[model samples]
Target chain A: MIVARTGNEAMAEAMRQVNPDVVAAYPITPATEIVQIFSSFVHDGLVDTKFVAVESEHSAMSACIGAAAAGARVMTGTASQGLALMHEMLFIAAALRLPIVLCVVNRSLSAPINIHCDHSDTLASRDSGWIQIYTENSQEAYDSVIQAVKISERALLPVMVTIDGFIISHGMERIDILDDREVREYLGEPPKRPNLLDIDKPITMGPLDLQDYFFEHKRSEIEGMNTSLPHIEAVAREYKERFGRYYPVIDTYRIDDAEVAVMAMGSAAGTAKVVVDRMREKGKKVGLIRMRVVRPFPKNYLKELIQGFAAVGIMDRSDTLSTLGGHLYVETRAVLYRASHQPPIKNYIYGLGGRDISLEEIEEIFEEVLEIGKSGKVTEPVVYKGVRE
Target chain B: MPSLKELIKKQDLLSGGHRACAGCGATIIVRQVLLAAQYPVVVGASTGCLEVVTTIFPYTAWKVPFIHSAFENVAATIAGVETGYRALKEKGKIKEEIRFIAFGGDGGTYDIGLQALSGAIERGHRMLYICYNNQAYMNTGIQRSSATPYCAHTTTSPAGKVIPGKPQFRKDLTEIVIAHDIPYAAQASLAYWNDLTKKVQKALEVDGPSFINVLSVCPLGWGVPSDMTVEIARLAVETCFWPLYEYENGKYIINRKPREKKPIEEFLKKQNRFRHIFRHPDRDKIIARIQKEIDRRWERLLKRAG
Candidate 1:
C-alpha cells in the first residue's frame, strides 16, 4: 500500500506487519514514536506481538536478548543514548548468536546533551558486532527494517537498521509498504535453533567461557560475520524478487563512470545524490556510494567499488574524536590500502549534532574532489564541513 | 503440599558434580525450587556463585533448560522469556505450559539488580524470581552488598579500629518486593527445605510475578565450617535475624514464629564475619542495636500479619 508516513511511522508500520512474537522496548526521543505507535497497535489488537513496556533501555535490550534466546522472533526500537545504554548487551546478543532486529533512529550522543541527527551514537557502537544498515529516507527505513529481520535471522546476527533522527523520523514522505499477508509469507516461519525454551532437548545459553574456549567461540563469531555477506545479499535478492525494490550493502549512484566520487550514509546519502545529479547535469563526473551495511565493513565490495575513481571524498556526520578523522574515513582509507591504484580520498566531517549539510556544501566537496581528480595531487585529508572554525 | 520423599522423587533437574563449594546454600535452594516446579521449566541464573559453578562452558549442571545472561538483569531476562513463551503459546507454536524461574544472588537482587527486579515485578510477568540471600557478594569474594547484614565484616565493609563493620542494615528486599503489590513474595531459609520448596511451588503457581528471598548461607564468605551451613541458617531463623514469612493476596503471613526468639549472638557468635563485634569494646552496644532492629522488624511483621 502507498502511504505518506514519517520514518518512525514507516518503521512502526513495518513492525506491525512483521508482527514479531515479542517486542520489549523503552522510549527515547526521535525513536519514541516507533514503539509508541507499535504499542498502540498491540492495544488495538492489530498485531499479536507481546509488547513489553520495559523501564529502561538496558532492560529493553536485555529483554530482547532473553526473548531471542527463547527462540522467538524479537525486535525493539531505540536511538542515541538508548542505543548507548544497550551497548554491553548488544555484544552479548551478537555473541549468543541471537538474531534480534533493533530499529535505531540515528541521533547525536550526549556531552552537551543534544537530541539531534548525527552518526555518533551508532558509529560509536560500530565495533559491537551488530549488522548496521543505514537508511536514506523513510521508504528505505521501512524496507530495511523488514529486510533486516531476514538478514539477521539468516546470518544469526543482530541487525541495527537506522534512519536519521528527526530528519527522517519526524519528517513525512511517500512510501510503499508490503501487505500484511505478503510480509507474513515473505518471512514465513521464525527460524528455529537450539533455544532456551526447548523442554526436552535442554540447552545452556550464555555460559561462562574461560580462556580455554572463549577464543575459539569468538573466532566462530567473527567467522559468522565474515561469511554473512552472502546471507545479506541472498535476503536482499529475495526481497527484491518478492517486492519490486532492492537494497544492497553498498549502494552506488553514477559511480561507475565518474572520476570523482563521494561516500555518504543514512540521510546524507539522499542529499549527496541530489548534488551528484545536479553536478552530472552540468557535465561534472561525480558520483555517490551510500553505505547501507557498515559492520563486517563490506571490505571486498568497497575495494571493488573504489577501483577506478581518481579521487574520492567521504562525508562523515560524526567525528571520531580521535583526530584521526571520522569512522568512515578511517575505515574506507584502510580498505583502499591494498588497492592497485589508490584514490586520493579526503574526509568531510559534516552535519554533526543535527546540523544541516546543504547540497551546495556537497557540490563544493565534489568540486574539490574533481580538482584533486584532475590534478592527481592531494591536500587536506580531513575537513569539518559546514561548521564555522 | 508434597512430602519430602514425594518432592525428591518427582525429578532431579539439577545434575550432580557441579563445581559449587561444599554446602553452598544457593545450589540447595536451586534444587528445591526446580523440584517444586510443576510444569516444564526454563531457568535463568545471574552471574553469581550458582551461575559460575553450574554453567561453565561445555559443562552445565542444569538438566532442564537454562540461561545465564549477565547479572543485574536476570529478572528482566526471565520476564522476557515468560512473555516470549506466552506469545509463542498464543501463536500455537508452543504447546506445553512452561514456568519461568530466575535465580539471582542477593548482590544481583538487592543491590545492582534492584531496578530490573522492580521493573519485572511491576510489569507482572508470570515468572518466579528467587534471590539466594547469602549476605554479601559471595561470588565476587565477599564484597559488601546491600543485602549484607549490619555489623558483618565483608571485604569492602571490613571491621577496623575506627569502624565496627557494615554500617547500614541489610535491605528488606522481600518487603520491597511486596511494595510492588505482587501476588506472592516471601522469605525462606534453606534450613527449612519444606518451607522453601512450598514457597517455590506457591510462587510458580501464581498467575502473576512472584519473588522469594531465600536465606542462603556461604561457608567461605561467612567464615563458618561447610557443615554449619544449614545449622547457621537455622540459628538465623531461631534468633529472628532472618524471619520466615510470606506476603500473599495482600496479606502478610509469618510462616514460622519461634516459641521463644533467641538472642542475636546465637547466630552471630558462630560466624567470624561477626566476630569483631563480639570482641569489640562496644560489643554489648552493637549486639543490642542488632537485636533491637530484628525485634522491631519482627514486631512489624506480627502487626502486618494480624
Candidate 2:
C-alpha cells in the first residue's frame, strides 16, 4: 500500500520501517523536521528505537559513531553548518566502515550564511569516503533512504542521502511510501551480529595505519566503494520487485535523440525535468539527465548515456576551489575524457545558497547548451545563470 | 590490597599489537580505563594521541565498540550514547547493563573541546569523561596547548633567550569541572595506576557526569627517555607539580599526598623541554613559582578533603 505523504513523513515512515536501533541527532534548520517526526514516533511508541538528543551537530555524528560502532543500525540527520561540524567524524565513520546512514538536507555553508537548498554542504564532504546520493523529489528522497541502508550495510560503507534544503526537505509533496510489511520484507532481517560487535569472534576495527600501510588501507576503502555499485543496483532491483518503485542510480528524462542534454541533481533536476517536457512538446531536442549517486561516481554509465549527445551542460550548486570550476563539471569532464566517445561539455554554476532555480532558468540553460554546441567552443569554466554581478 | 588476579580481568577491549609509540602514556591510560570499566561499555574518543594510535582504517586496536569523533565532541558524544542507552533500557529493548565513557587529550578536553564538555555536564548525562592531560598537542608534534605548564618548552612555545618557555600556567581544568557541581570529578596520574583505577571505579558508580583529569606524560613530546615515562609522571606528583585528588558532590578529597616534597629540579632535569629553565636562572624562578602554585593548590585540596 502507498500513502501520499510529505518528504519529512516519508523519511520518518521509512525509518520506522527499518527500526534503527539508535537515532542520534541535534536539531538544525531544514533537517530538524526529520528528527522531530522521528522523535514523535519514539514518544508515541510507534517505533522501538533509542532517540539521543545531542547538544550539537558535532555530538550528533559523534554519538552516531558510538552507536554504529556498538553494532546498532544508527541514523542521523543534519544540514549546512551542522554537516560541516561533523566533518571530522564523517571521515571516521567511513574509515571505521560502520555503515551509518545519514540524511543530509543540503544547505549552503556559512560565512555569509544562508539556510536553503544547495549542494555546498555535501559537496564539502565529497572526499570524506561516503557514498553520496542526491534525490530530486519526495518520492526519490524516501526511496533512496531505505535503499541507502541496504547498500551501506551490504557494502560495509557509510551512505549519505542528500535532499535539497527547504526545497525537498521542507516542501510538502505527494510521495508513495512502501507499507511497513513491504519495507521489512525488502530490507530483510537486520544483521544479527554486525562485524564490529561479534563478541565470540573479536575483530579489530579502525586501527592505526602507519605510513607503510596507509595507502593499502585507503586502497581497500576504494575497492570496497567500487564493489558497492553492483550491490546498490541489486538492492534497487529488489526494492522494485517488492514495492513496484523503480529507483535508478542515474535517471534520464527524454535524452534518447537529443543533441543537447542538461545534467543536474537534487530538486533542481525536478525543474529540469519539467523544462525538458515543455521543450520536447515544442519540438525541441533538449533533454535532462539527473545524477543520483554522486560518489563512487557512475562514470562509465554516465559516459555511455552521454555518448550520442553532441553537447552536455553540467549544472552545479557547489564550487571547487581554484579557477571557479564547479564539482560536477570537473567530474563530468573527467568521465567524458575517459569514455570511448566524448562530447562538448559546458559548465553552469547556478541556484547557489538556496536561490530559486525555476523551470524558466532550466530552459535558459538548455538554450545555452545548444548555443555552445553550435559554436563548438567554451569560455570560462563557470557561467553564472539567473544572477546579477 | 586486592590481588591483580582477584581483580576482574576484562577481555582486552583495546587489544594489543597496535602501533602506539613504545611508552605512549595516552595509550596506557586508555587501556587502563577500558579494563577498569565494566562490560558492555561504550567508548567515545576525541581526535588526539590515543585516537590516532588506535584507529586507522582496516586496523583498529580496539576490540570493543569504540568511536573516534572530532577533537571537541568526546564529552557530548558520550552524553548522547548515555542518553541512547537510557532510552533503550526504558523501552525494554536493551536489558544488559552498560556504561558510557569518553577519552580525550589535554588539548581536546581543556581547550577545543571545553564548550561541548561544559554542555554535556550541564545536561546531566550519566557518563565519565577522562581527560588524558599530556600538557601539549603531542599528536600534532608537540605544539603548546592550554594545559601546558609554565616554563615547559613546546614547539610552539619555545624557551628562547628572550621569551622563556610557556609563560602562562596550565589551566585549572579540575577546578572548572568541580565548579559545575556534577556528581563527581577528580585528578589522577598515570604514575599511580591503583589510585587512577580507584577513581575510575568511583566515577563509574556515580549517576551523573563524572570528570577525570589524568596527568599522562608524553615521553616523545616531553623530550624524556621512552623508558622513563612512568618515572617522570611519579616525580611530577612527588615534586608537588601534579597533585592527585578527587571532588565528589561539592566535597574535595586528595587521593595521593606527597609526604616529603622533592625539589622541582628533579622533575625538570629529566625532560629536555625544561632544559632551558636550568640554563637560565631567571627562568628557574618562573618554574619555581609554578611549583609553588601547585603546592598551594595541594594544600587547599588537603584542607577540603579534611
Candidate 3:
C-alpha cells in the first residue's frame, strides 16, 4: 500500500516489518528520527526487539556487533558524526563478517560541524567493507532497508543504507510498503552460521588476524565482495518477483542512445534525472546513470554502461582531498581506463555540506558533458559547482 | 556452592595450549571464573592480554562461545549479546539457560573501556563483567594505564631522573562500577581464590548487571619473578593496597579484613617495579607517602563497610 512518509518514517516502517531481534543506536540529527521512530514502535509492542539506546555511535555499533555476533538479526542508525564515531568499530564489524544493517541518514562530516546532507559521511566508508547503498527518495529508502537486511544476511557482510539528510530524510514522499507478513516471510529466520551464540557448538568470533593471516582474511573479503554481484542481482530479482518493484545496482535513465551522460548517486540523482529528461525533450543527447549499490561497486556493469557514452560528467557530493577526483569519480575513471571506450570524463564536486544542487546546475553539467563529447577532450578535469572557489 | 571436589572435577572451559605467559594472573582468573559458572556460558573479551593471547588464526583457547571485538567495548559487546539473549529467550528461541560474561585487562577496563562498561551496567544488562586488573597495559609492553599504581615503574611511567613512576593514584574502578549502582559490584584477587571464585559465582547468577574487579598481577609489567605472581597479589591484599569487598544494592560488605594489616613495603619490595622508589634520595619519605595513600584508602573502605 502507498503511504506518505518521510525517508526516516519509511525506513522505520521497513525496520518494523524486518523486525530484527536487536537495534542498538544513538540519536544523531537527520538519522535520529529513524531510531526514535523505531523506539516508539518498540514502546507500542509492535515488534519484539531489544532496543539498546547506547551512549555513543561507538557503543551503538559495538552493541550491534555483539548482538549480531550472538546470532540475532541486528540493526542500528547514525549520521555523519555518529558514523564517524563508529569508524573504528565499522571495520571490526565487517572484518568479523557480522550482518548488521546500519541505516545512515547521510550528512556532512565535521570540521566546522555542519549537520547537512553530503556524501562525505558514507562515502568516507567506501573501504570499510560494508555493502553501501544510497536511495534517491523515501520510496527507495524504505525498499533499500529491507533489501539491505536480506543482502547483508545472505552475503554475511554488514550493509549501510544511506538516505540524504534533510533532502530525502526530512522530506515526504509516497512510499509503497509491503505487508508485514510478506516482509517477515521474505527475511524468514536468519541464516545460521558456524560462528554464533550457540552453546553446543562454540567458536571464536573476531580473532586477532595479524601478519600471517590478516591478508588471507582480507583476500576472503575480496572473494566475498566479488561473489556479491550475483547475490545482489539475485536478491533484486527475487524482490521484484515478490514485491513487483525493480532495483538495479546502477540505475540508468534514457542512456540507451545518449552520447553525453551525467553519473551521480543519492538524492541528487533525482534532480539529475529531471535534467536528463528536460534535455531529452529539447532533443539533447544527454542521459543519467545513478548508482544504488556503491560498495562491491558494480565495476564490470558500470564500465559496460558508461563505455557506450562518448563523454560523461561525474557529480561527486564529497571531496576526496586529492589531486585525483572525488572517491566515486576516481573509482569510475580507474574502471573506465580498462574499458574499450575512453570517455573524456569531467568531475563536478557539488552539494557539499548540504548545498542544494539546482536543476539549472545539473543542466549546466549536461551542457558541459555535451561540450566534452564534441571537443573529445576534458580541458577542465574538476569543477567545484555552486561553491565560491 | 560447588564442592572443592566438584570444582576441580569441572571440565576446564579455557583449554590448554594457549600463548599466555607463565604465572599470568589474568589467565588464572579466566579459568577460575569459568569454573565458578554454573551453566553454559558465552564469553566476550576486549583486545588485550586475554583476547590476543587466547585466540590466533586456527587455534582458540576457549571452549565457550567467545567473542573478541576491539579494545574498548567488551562490556558493550557482552551487553549486546545479553540483550540479544533476552530478546531471543523472550521469543522462545533460546531454549537453554545460557550465561554471558565479559573479560578485559586494566588497559581495556580502567582506561579505554570505562565508558562502555559504564553504559552497559547503566542499561542493566544481564552479564558479568570481569576486569583482570593487571594495573597497566601489559599486552602493549607495560605502558601506564589508569590502573597503574603510584610509584610503580611501568614502561610509560618509568621512575626517571626527576620523578617517581605514575605520580597519580590508581583509579578505583570497582568503586566506579559501584557508582553505576548495578545489581552487584565487587573486588577480589588471585590471592584469595575462595573469595574471588565465590564472587564470580555470585556475579554469574545475578539477574542483571554485575561487575567484579580482580587485582591480577603482571610479572613482566610489575618487574616481579614469574613464580612470585600469586605471592605479590597476596601482599597487595595483606598490605591493604587492594581491598576485598562487595557493594550490592547500596550495601557495602567487606569480604576479608585482615586482623593485622602488613606494611605497604611488604608489597612494594616483592617487585622491582617499586625498586627505584626505594633508591630515591628521600627513600623513607617516599615509602611513607605510598603507605599513607594505601592506609587512607583502606580507612575509607572500613568507613564504607561499616
- lDDT by residue (B32-61, candidate 2, tens digit) is 777776556667788887887777756777
Per-model C-alpha RMSD: 1.2, 3.6, 1.1
Model 3 residue runs over 4 Å out of place are A29-31
- Expressed as tens digits, the lDDT of each residue in B60-148 for candidate 3 is 99999999889999989888888888888888888989889999898899988988988888888988999999998989889999998
TM value for model 2: 0.88
DockQ of candidate model 1: 0.82
User: Which residue pairs show backbone clashes in model 3?
Assistant: none
Q: Candidate 1, residues B159-278: lDDT per residue as tens digits?
A: 989898899998888988999999999999999998987898898889999999999999999999999999999999999899999999999999999999999988999999999998
Q: What is the DockQ of each candidate?
A: 0.82, 0.37, 0.82
Model 2, A1-389: lDDT tens digits are 55676666777777888888788888865355788898999999888788777777887887787667666778888888889988988998897777889888888988677887779899999999999999888888888899989988898889999888777777888776767887777777556544433334545445556788888878998898888899889988988887788878898888878988989988888888889989889988988899999887998899899888878899998878668478999989888887777778888889888888788888988987888778867776578787799
Candidate 3, position A385, lDDT: 96
Fnat (0 to 1) per candidate? 0.72, 0.36, 0.76
Model 3, residue B101: C-alpha shift (Å): 0.7
lDDT of 3: 0.89
Which tens-of-lDDT digit does each residue in A1-389 have in candidate 3? 98899999999999999999999998865356899999999999999998998887898999999898888999988999999889999998998888999889989998868898999989888898999988999898898899889999899899999999999889989878899999999989998866456888998988877899889999998788778877778899999999998899999989888988889999999998888888999999888999899889899999988888889999999988989878789999899889988888999999989999999999999998898899899888988999996
Instruction: Report the lDDT tens digits of candidate 1 across residue range A150-194.
Output: 989999999999999999999999999888999999998977888
Please give, as one word, the docking class of candidate 1: high
Rank candidates by lDDT, best first: 1, 3, 2
